[model samples]
Target: MEKSEFDLIKSYFAPLASGYEEAFDLLNDAALISEKPQASTVVTMDTLIAGVHFLMSDPAGDIARKCLRVNLSDLAAMGAAAFGYSLSMAYNSQIDVGWVKEFTTALGEDQQRFSCHLIGGDTVVTPGPLTITITCFGSVARHQCLKRNTAEVGEDVWVSGDLGDSAAGLKLLNKELDVSDAEARAQLIHRYRVPEPRCDLGIELLQNAISRTAMDVSDGLLADLGHIARASNIAVELYEDKIPRSAAFSALMSSSPDLGLALAVTGGDDYEIVFTSDPAQEQAIQELSRKLSLKLSKIGKVVSGHGVRLICRNGKTFLPTKAGWTHF
Candidate 1:
């Protein structure tokens, strides 16, 4: 008796689409488009469910942006540029016409910002929580793409932007902290809603051979660095004092002594780039950051060991209780 929201949204995509089925035709055969000479294609996919990846109370538009950004962060980890993407959505009955419009508007804006073209995807009615799946494809020169297993001893560890913002933002949403300042609260909330993917920085690093190995800090710094250490078969030693902290985060740490800095070190969803380079490339990275107006700082160095060790200024060893988030 009622026109479904899915039908209404499907009509909007039909007119502007090149061909929905044609877009997926390439993927259906289990083969990607042929690679260019001496070039490599980087592909990554991430799925987010309403309650699992986001709160049901969050704005639909913000949820849509998060779905795209988290997937884009994966591409940044390998120093890839966005080429195209596909989205599969499982819509529940609760998706009203206004919600769909807002969600699609945000998705379109992100697609433009990231320079990615949406090919095609399946949308269907579901009986459960809202689910969105995005698969992103990117490209890099064969030798330029940073691999997780490429870190070397003596390589300098670097991170772009301060850590702990996203985790702190979530805490604020849960009302764990009562930050009275509007601007400070807004900054934390922004980190949670729209994570900067560091795509431009990642591409520049690859093009200029700035980083020997790289990974985006979707997970917390300490935990993510541990991943690079494990993957590259090298140990990493980070100076706790050297790790950068945002002004808001610093204030939170000072006020909430029980809320350990370890959360910032081990929390997830920072989405900044964590990379490894050496002394030889340090100047080059610095130059690139200056030219691009990106803040890139060396926080630590790779060592010869199996795991990560945090060295405090007082010569105390700090090991994180948790490594990172596990979907399983």
Candidate 2:
């Protein structure tokens, strides 16, 4: 039997709205979000296209999770608690009911893990490759949202978890690099496929008044920090050794030190949070890190100037030929 678009939604997507009464079982054209007193809504959207954002050969479940997680990373950057998301998918002949079942199963798992619900969305057939777009909605205290321009001079720059694993993972996946260690190889590939968003850290930073300036490192760390520097009209002095790296990343770097450092600093797809806070909050930040069991590394500081500078261990400055990934 040929399945229609409505059948696709009813079978795979409608069940994702189990807890969200306002979603109306994905039958309505739109979903309603009631106002929460003294709170502001945060909305973020991201689109992923086949062969561009992800490989077509990847597992359908992973592809679905990555699509949702990237948008969740955006909400985390703003210190927002995700409530719900609206998903849109354009599928080609390559996708079938079985593939969609796996995809929606992943979304259902993530919805439970993140405490968010699926609201509504549209599905359409396209002759081109499959594409997915997700719009995530979250909430934060009124007028207390984090901003890139709110960084103050002399504040400490911090990042959650290790870096460069994702880029290394991509290299391995593309066969540009090979790892002797099977465990390390698998870890890197996993990081590339599924990025962990620092939602709790973002909320702690904003709610506790620990920091006001933050942005997730979707691009290279250097490039994203450059954003904070440019936005705040300040300069950043980053210590190359201070940038955190996992054991797998370090092993890869041990084989190629220069390339490792460059990739770690400039490689994109690291969804970790890069935030700034006053030095006085160091103890509090450390406590938060321990409480959350997430590594928070203090990598640099904001100074009065323009642009970002990477300082090497030898007290010399190191500059990359290319700053980061760019669409253009």
Candidate 3:
């Protein structure tokens, strides 16, 4: 016999909603969210299809974490602190009671780690692929949220942490790339599975007034940069050499510099925050880096023009085969 939807909610999800009082214990059709004084609500949503966002063979817990973190990353981009989330899970036949247990267990752990709760959501059986959609709610200082179109000409461009590991990790999983080092393989694949949302960095950026223009690198660095550029009506001059890479990532692509760098910038899924700030903020950013213990790389600067230009190590312009990933 299969578990009923209400049974699953009581057994697994209700406990997760314990963080917020207004969740109504998930008994009501909808949960009410109220904003705090002087704080504005920040909402972000992301959908994950089994084959599209993750693999069916991937660990159920990891899939749940990834689904949640990606949306959290969006909150981080807006310099917001997450409070709770509503999850709509489209489960397929392959999902069983045991699988739900594993999935919800991870969500419980992450809720504790992120200081959030599952306010409300729906679970329905799907005839198609297993899908997860998370609508996350966060709070930010009123009228003080990061905006993509705020990049200013002559400001320094920056990226947090390393890039390309996730993309390369996916390639390793698909057997398109060969990595001989076991630790390297693990490092790359772990990045693909779990992303580190720079929540602290976002908070610092907002609280200290270090930057005003920012977004997380989700769809790929180059492609995402294009969004800021077009939105701000400015051009970006990216130095290929300045794009940071992890030791594992560098080792994996050492022999093929061109291909390696291309994949690193265009592979997407990095989830690191990218922002533009005045050159005067460099010192503050460096201090923040040390405080957060996360590497923040200034790879480029905003220029008065359109689109992005990748400057090669040889001091010449280099164009990638493709800018980034697209569903279509």
Clashes of each: 0, 0, 0
Steric clash pairs (candidate 3) = none
Candidate 2 lDDT by residue in tens digits, 192-227 = 888887888888888998889999988888889889
The collision pairs in model 2 are none
lDDT of 1: 0.78
Per-residue error for 208 in candidate 1, Å, reads 1.1
- Residues forming the 10-long window of minimal summed lDDT in candidate 3: 319-328
Candidate 1 structure, TM-score to reference:
0.89
Which candidate wins on lDDT?
3
- Give the per-residue Cα lDDT of candidate 3 at 87: 99
lDDT score of residue 285 within candidate 3: 97
TM-score of each prediction: 0.89, 0.97, 0.97
Give the per-residue lDDT digits (tens) of candidate 1, residues 182-224. 8988998888877888898888877877875888887677778
Ranking by TM-score: 3, 2, 1
Off-target runs (Cα >4 Å) in candidate 1 are 1-9, 14-38, 257-260, 322-328
